[model samples]
Target: MAAMATWFLIVIYLAFISLGLPDSLLGAAWPVMRPDLGAPLEAAGMLAMIVAGGTIVSSLASGRLIDKLGTGPITLISCLMTAAALLGFSFAPSLLWFALLAIPLGLGAGAVDAALNHYVATHYEAHHMSWLHCFWGVGATGGPLLISYFIKEHDSWRAGYTAVAIIQVALVTILLATLPLWKKVAAQRSMLRASSRPHHSDASVKGSNKFTAKTDREEDIRPSAQPMRLPGVKMSMLAFLFYCGVETLVGLWGASFLVGARGIPAETAAWWISLYYGGITIGRLITGFITLKVSNRILILVGPLISALGAVLLLLPLPGAITLAGFVLIGFGFAPVYPGLIHETPVRFGRANSAKLIGYQMAVAYTGTTFLPPLFGLLASQAGIGLFPVVSLLLIVLMLLCSEYVNRAIKRKYLIA
Candidate 1:
């Protein structure tokens, strides 16, 4: 049983990493594609928004499918769809075709995102869930680095997509093979426990009859069929709104900041963008290891403060090296916030409500990602590149304030440790 659980986590982690690769490719390859596709700045920004929008809508549908179909089948479908979409994207004849492909890609990615998180939380230990997310960070970091290397070598971006497609196919095969083993292990464990205990089926029947009236009354007194509202839900939405803002801001604008603001060469700026995600990658792994011991509330509070400091340093007239350091800190600071929120959802709302809560959370967050960066880009186009960090700093402040409120709300609920 333990071995099966361990292997299950490993497979989930691999799927997450594989899932993140295409976005990383697009992020790193954007500079190259913009000119090739003759896309304006708005169109460039829309590329991300289009994909995020698709994910947002698909996630809502995915939650219900996950409940009905279970994780293994849903994961397989998502992986296969993702591979097909990437291949379509690779051969796209025009920007329109590319945009069209992003829709399915987004759907696949979003389905996997919600399904995997739910699976890990329901089936695995809490600490292992953290580790599973760390592997997601690993994939996020690898995407850009891999794409950049191929571009530098003058290889086709299509090759990158092809490689990821192969990986996804292999992951699907491995998961299908191992799933029956996991089910068998679970059944055996249940049987072993059953053998050692007096059967309670008859007692349960008698107790159920006695509790029938009480059960009806309890149901009447229970909260409405509407999802239980968490005090933090509103604030968490705002924080994640800002979270999407910050993450997309950095992912979309990091290279732009280096080139437009710092006067670094284009290729050099792309490489520097890797540094930001690299910090995120390392930071998530560290957070996963340490979060079990540390106060989650304290960690949440501290994250924005660190990120705020990074934004301040970026706003200064510092050397390129120093500015890069700032981005590194920002990446590390931003790393744990989103996953932390997702982790806390089940903790705050109970497992039954988690899918609905996460569905709404992801939808709103993607909406922010869709619009916020373009707003910054507009500011940059009109005002100057200097406004980028200033805007990000303001959003960080809002996130910090919301985090404080969210902590208090969690304490009030007292469901989570």
Candidate 2:
């Protein structure tokens, strides 16, 4: 069973790769793609907004879908949808086509993300959750590199999209093949949990239907049926909102902060931002090992505090080297927070509610990803980018406070650790 679950983890990692592949392809290829489609470069922002909107909607609706269809079918279908969308992107002759394709692409990506996070959180160890997300970072980083290679060598962004689309197709095939692994593992987990508790965690396939069957009339989807009014739920949303806000703010403004405040070159600042993402990747790798020993609550609480230190480092009147190191510190600190929070949702909220709350958490996280950085940008424009570290520190503090509050609320009311 462990071995089967481990193999399933590998498949999930591949799906995460597919998830990451489409994400940066648009950004990297948009420069060349825009001219070919006769679209303005700024239209990328419009397409991005469209994609984000689709993702937000998809995430918000994932709980119902996952409950009915199961994670395996959701994974398979989501990957297939994304694969088709990406292939369509390769053939899109106009920005309008790209806009249309972005919808399914975003929806597919969100379903995969939300379903897989909840699946891993409920089924696997804390370390696996951290590693699962690290795979996402791997995918995110690989997309740009893959697209850049096609542009540099073939001089065609279309070829790049085709190449990535082909990869997504391959992952879809793998997902289709491994549908039973998800079923098998989930069945085992459900039985074990049933033995230990009284019919909790209905993350299994409902009554022998292989793929997508319209099975409704089951009341197992809701743990409480009213999780929205819970203090822990609200606090979790607030924490994710602030946490993701801090992360995206750093990514969007790191170079700007260096250039505006520290008088650094754009090229050099880009290198430092690379270091920042590198810190996140490497830090997640280390965090995988760290979670073996530490609890998610500790990881979540400490992550922001460490990020606060990084923000402090940026705010100090330090040397350029130290300021650059601050970005790495921030990235390292951020590494464990998101995954830790996701993994703890089941423990804090209970497994029966994991799907729904995780969906909410992811939706709010994406909402933060969508809006917070830009909101901070508005503030930065008014006050100058010198407020970079200052605002980051403030957001980190809010994230930490909300996260800690949720932890305590769960412990007090739910008797959860």
Candidate 3:
């Protein structure tokens, strides 16, 4: 059983890497694809928004779908959908076709993201959670390099996406083979719940059996009796919103900011942007080790504080080297936030309610991802890309404030173990 669990986790880690594969491809490939497809450079914002909108919609519905269909099937179907969308990108004739393809891509991404996050939070250790996201960072870092290489070699962005689609198709085949693993986990959880049911302290009838057939069937059909109607959940969502906004804004436009504001060469700017993601990948690797000794609460608080220092570095009137250092710091600072918050979900809320709460969190996060970066694009168009740092600083401050409020709320209202 232990070996099976380990193998299951290995598959999940690979799935996470696949998840990150397509995420940064657009941002890296866009500068080249934009002119080729007759798109204004700013139009990337619209593409991002479209993708975010699709993610938001899918995330909002994932709880119900997962409840009905289970994680294994949802993951398999989402991967296939995403693969199809990537194929669409490879063959797209214009920007409109790209926009149209983003729908299924977003839908696929959100479902897989929510399903896997909730699954890991409930079943895995904090270090596993951190490492899973670290793997995602690895894929995110790889994506741009792949696109950059293909563009340099073939002068065609389509080649980059086509390669990604092929990878996704391969992953889908792996997922299909592993379907039984998800079912095994589900069955084990069900039996555990059954074995513990009769021991409920509040049972009214002495020597009563809570693991009746009817009870088992009911639980299998619907796990949570009540929705996660909690007070601190709203603040948590707001914090996620700001964090997603900050991360997306940085990833999507960081290269543009370097080129337009600092007069960095395009090749050098792309390298720096990849370096920024590399910082995230490396930082998460460190974060996974840190989790062995540090409490997640303290780590969560520390991440944004570090991020603030990075934002200040960006605002400083310094050399391009300093600015590059600022981005690296920012990426490192953000490393622990997303996964850290998620790892705490089952602790903050009971396991029964976690799926629903996480779904809502995913939706709000994507909403921010959908709108904030494009808004930054518009601001940069008018006020110069210098506004990038200012906007980033403000968002980081807001994220920090929200985290503080959430920490306070959770401590005051609930006992977290």
User: Using TM-score as the measure, which candidate wins?
Assistant: 3
lDDT values, one for every candidate: 0.71, 0.74, 0.78
Q: Pairing residues by index, what is the TM-score of model 1?
A: 0.84
lDDT of 1 at 235: 84
Q: Candidate 2: which stretches are off by over 4 Å?
A: 24-46, 87-98, 147-163, 189-226, 252-275, 312-324, 346-355, 374-391, 407-417
- Give me candidate 2's TM-score against the actual structure: 0.74
Which sequence of candidate numbers ranks them by TM-score, best first? 3, 1, 2
Shift of residue 307 alpha carbon in model 3, Å? 1.9
Better of 1 and 3 by TM-score: 3
**Evaluation by lDDT, superior candidate among 1 and 2:** 2
- Give all TM-scores, in the order shown: 0.84, 0.74, 0.85
RMSD of each: 7.1, 7.9, 7.0
For candidate 2, write residues 278-316 as lDDT tens digits.
677777888887766666677777777778999999999
Please, what are the lDDT tens digits per residue for candidate 1 over residues 1-417? 566656656777888876666656676666666677787655656777788888787777876897687667777788788888887866787899888988888888888887887666555545555566667667666766666676677655566666666766787788677666544644554565566653222111123222223323432245325653655778888878888777777778777777667888655666666777777778778877666566455567777888889889999998989888888888888877777777665444444565667778887887888788877777777887667789889988998888678767756544442
Q: Residue 18 CA error for candidate 2 (Å)? A: 1.8
Which structure is stronger by lDDT: 2 or 3? Answer: 3
- TM-score of decoy 3: 0.85
